[model samples]
Target: MPATHATEHSITVAAPPAVVYGLIADVAGWPAVFGPTVHVDVLEEADPERGGEQLLRIWATANGRVRAWTSRRVLDPAARTVLFRQTVPAAPVASMGGEWRVESTGDGTSRVVLLHDYRAVDDDPAAEELIARAVDRNSHAELAALKEAAEQGELRDELHFVFSDSETVAGDAGDVYAFLDRADLWPQRLPHVSRLDLTEDEPGVQHMDMDTRSPDGSVHNTTSIRVCFADRGLIVYKQLKVPVAMSGHTGRWEIEPLGDGTVRVTSWHTVTLDPEGVRTALGAEATPAEARALVRKALGTNSSTTLRHARRFAEEARARA
Candidate 1:
């Protein structure tokens, strides 16, 4: 009997070959960058010259569920290529393997080819087309996101004053508390955040450099200290250094654990105005009421976007666990 298979897709990204390679090469970090759709757990690291390869356990969630697979990496650093073979353990009906090749195209552009070879374990003719189409769609989406992140440099400096309200996932306080304590996960999940360096000043107090992006494509670098009140189920972050537009800004995140493994999270941010810019941006003639309304609108939009990403992260973490 002939082995069943699926199709592959490719896309070119406008970035240096190294950058493109680095992004994909950092396979263990995929879950944070790729959102909740894909999870890559690293079983081994890469050592290119010695013919060492990375191994990853892959899980993909779609239509409210997850499917798991194991892949063995075969990487060629000199050629800038990484290939993987899917090992299907239980689900014999489907299999997938792919290669990522990066080549330099002059003028700081790189051509990326993502090719996949897939086979259906069982002889299910009808499922082949469906699986192929789904794989194509997913591959395209993944490339598009990678392109954006690469070209945009992953860190964004788009800042805004905002308020957010979140109810704990599954209504569990302990889970919520544990999740919030892991601030390291934020940089992985939020695209606008490039790096979050943290230092402990004292017990329960941590200082951090939050390198984030702003709405107008500017980078906002803020240094803040977070005081954790684990017993009270609260964490407060007070900004020490902020951009001109966000001077005197302070933000706080509060998690009130409700029974049944859920918590209510609320975030409040206050900004001190720069008279010159605010007057010019909002118009010197605009009243305080108008300014407040405008600020609220911007904040609301930011909050909504943040919440959507946060929810996806929380849901995926729960599912994976």
Candidate 2:
């Protein structure tokens, strides 16, 4: 018989059910919400937040070692719960599944429950314990962070947007992936980049800190965590630290090969505006219209640069192959 293990943890946060649910539903923000999570990549999005399936690539620390895995998840806002199972289980974990439940305890409060059920690799007791430790530690941190985020302010009504650009090149997807996957070498390859500090503490997972010169001639320093999905030809990144005007920022890079002997490289971004810091980031003369336009242009410019560079590099690499 396979050794099965179950673990559950709960916390009461002074926030509403919907508020708590939103924090749980936004998988991309897990790096900030959970202490152990280094990055989260959404392979496929769940649009409705309820009765919709979402596929995710998660990179987290287990017993001090970074681990990466993908999960198939379903969300149900009405029931205030989300369900997930590992689509590609990592080592020491044969199978794993879990759910998030948020129950309203009062007008301005909620009780959040996190549950997990799993069987270890080879049904070994040692593997089971390792998995349990990871789950327990992460679940607790996530719940507490969710509670804190909910009680912060009325952020649910903030503006969120995604911008993307793509370039078609006569190269293969492998070259494109190699270029983006290797960020430590970006400073030498990309001009706008002034400095870069990168670490792949875990394979396929990266912690990157870099400085870039914005269009306005101002240098901005940002810290982000990224996860690469080699199979899907995708890479996802979330900023753990950002400028004052942004509340959340997440990005994606995808390399696809077309039948016509051309490959397309695309970069995408989703960001939420921080209402309280807009004036400070932009000058006093900046209107809401101007702020939005500036943000879109800036983000689009950077992503467009990446796509173009990847195209050229990939084509050259493919030519030699």
Predicted candidate 1 versus true structure: per-residue lDDT over 1-321, tens digit per residue: 666564656777888888888777777545434432334557888874544577777655432234456788887777888888876532433667878888898889988888887765575666566566656767787787667656754331222234555644554454555556666776886666677887764566666787876577777677765667788767755565645433345555676656656556666665444444556766777544455566655545554555556555566667777
Badly placed stretches (over 4 Å) of model 1 are 48-51, 89-93, 154-321
Summing lDDT over every window of 10 consecutive residues in candidate 2, give the lowest-scoring window.
152-161
lDDT for position 91 in model 2: 92
Error of 2 at 190 (Å): 0.7
For model 1, give the 10-residue run with minimal summed lDDT: 153-162
- Name the regions of candidate 2 deviating beyond 4 angstroms: 1-57, 61-65, 70-79, 82-99, 106-109, 115-137, 144-157, 283-291, 318-321
Using alpha carbons, what is the TM-score of model 2?
A: 0.71
Candidates in order have lDDT scores of 0.62, 0.81
> Total clashing residue pairs per candidate?
20, 0
